[model samples]
Structure formats: structure tokens, C-alpha cells
Target: MKQLYDQRISCPHCGHHIFVSLDASEGDQDYYEDCAACCNPIHLNMHIDYAINKLELRVDADDEQVF
Candidate 1:
């Protein structure tokens, strides 16, 4: 039950907004994505709240949380 969706997120390194893939069915995950503007790896921490049908994401650069 892997549902993939494109989610817009800001790059921590360059502050550029980019769309990244998100898999809600994975429940929760931690991964990295390269920023389109800066080419820097951004750490993504995802949490799914099934009860509320919502997804919470934390984008980070160098282990520092951005949002």
C-alpha cells in the first residue's frame, strides 16, 4: 500500500522550493533528497498520522531541522 505523492518542500541549503516524492503508505521514513537549486542533500524525516489522514515532514540540512 505504497502511495507516492509529490510534495513541495523548501531546500535548506538554498531556500528554493522543490517537489519531492512522498510515500504515505510507508507509514514513516527517513531519507535524503538532493536539492534542485543547490544540489545539496536534504534529510527528510516523515511521519504519518493515519488517524487524521495527515503527513508530517521535517526537512533538514546537515542534521539541522529547517521546517
Candidate 2:
């Protein structure tokens, strides 16, 4: 299916705003990226529900996985 991915989310640790580009056409996925502000590792989860047209993203650090 087609997808639209455009959203800016701030890092929870350093509060640095980063543009997240998630491919909604793909399946549910998880990945890791570094925060440009703090240079810390971040676990990124992209949840796209095609049935409801919903997109959810959760980003966190190694120490802080929920916040």
C-alpha cells in the first residue's frame, strides 16, 4: 500500500527535535538511530496500522526505554 511519512519528534533525552521518516508502506518495524543533539543511541519503533490508517512512533534511549 501507499504511505505518507512526515513528522518531527523531539528526543526525550536531549529534547532535540528530529525529523522522523518512517515508511508506512512497509510492515511494523523497529530500528535505532543516534540523537544529533546528544549523540546518544535511540531505539525507534514505527507502528503503522493499515486497517485503521494510524501511525504511531516510540523513540527512546538504552537507559530510558519508555520515556
Candidate 3:
């Protein structure tokens, strides 16, 4: 399996599309990265579902995203 996966997400600040690199080996993670378009912070959350064998991601602004 690939350790890194490319995820496409929209920047909550400027509504621009951006691609982020996520590491699957970490299992679960939360981090912030600057948006390439808006130059604002983008919150990213990722989780691994071993049962379905898939990686789930959530992107938000400075607040937490509700499922």
C-alpha cells in the first residue's frame, strides 16, 4: 500500500481547490497547512478504517468539522 495519498480538498477560507499529502502510516492525524491560494491556515483531519480498508479525511477552516 502507498504510504502517502493525494487528497483533494477545498480551502474553507477562499473556496479554492487544493491537494494535500496524507500519510496512511500514521493511522490518525490532525494538522494545519497553509492554503496555496488564500495563504490561510487549513485544518485537516484523517482517519484510517481498517475494516473497509480506506482512508477518510475531513477538511475545515480554523474550526472543527462536524460529521
Candidate 4:
């Protein structure tokens, strides 16, 4: 598996497409990045599935609530 990779995601606030760099070497991670278009903080949750050799990314706005 590649330690470093890039994924394209849409900003939850502005819906603008952007590329984000991810490092699988760090394992699962939770971070935030400012959206290029909307300038809102984007919550990024990364999960690595070693069994399936897959990386899953969840993108959302920081202010989102889960019900």
C-alpha cells in the first residue's frame, strides 16, 4: 500500500472539488482543513482497513451534527 496518496473530495460547505493528501503510514486520523472555496473548516476522518487493503475517507463540515 502506498504510504502517501491524494484523494479528491467535495467541500461540504461549498461543494467545490479539491484534492487532499493522505498518509496511510500514520494510520487512522482525524483532521481539519479549510475549504479553498468556502473557507470553512472541513472535517476529515480517515480510516484504514488493513484486512481489505482499503482506505476510507469521510468528509464533512465541522458544524455538522449526527442524528
Candidate number achieving the greatest TM-score relative to the actual structure: 4
**TM-scores for every candidate against the unseen true structure:** 0.78, 0.78, 0.83, 0.90
lDDT of 1 at 22: 91
The lDDT of each candidate is 0.86, 0.81, 0.86, 0.92
Alpha carbon lDDT at 65, candidate 2: 53
Better of 2 and 4 by lDDT: 4
How much does candidate 1 score in TM-score? 0.78
Model 4: runs farther than 4 Å from truth? none
- The alpha-carbon lDDT assigned to residue 53 of candidate 2 equals 75
Clashing pairs in 2: none
Put down candidate 2 lDDT per residue, 1-67, tens digits, no spaces. Answer: 4586877888878999988777877778899888888987778898877788788888877584565
Which of 2 and 3 is ahead in TM-score? 3
Candidate 1 off by > 4 Å: 65-67
Model 4 TM-score on a 0 to 1 scale: 0.90
Give every collision pair in model 1: none
Q: How well is each residue in 1-67 modelled by candidate 3, as lDDT tens digits? A: 5689987889998999988889999778999999998799998888888888888888888765689
Please rank every candidate by lDDT, starting with the best.
Answer: 4, 3, 1, 2
Candidate 1, residues 1-67, lDDT tens digits: the string is 3478888989988899999889787679999889877899999999988788778899989764578
Error of 3 at 49 (Å): 1.0
Best by lDDT: 4
Off by over 4 Å in 3: 64-67
lDDT of 2 at 63: 80
Candidate that beats the other on TM-score, 1 or 3, i.e. the better one: 3
Q: Which one wins by TM-score: 1 or 4?
A: 4
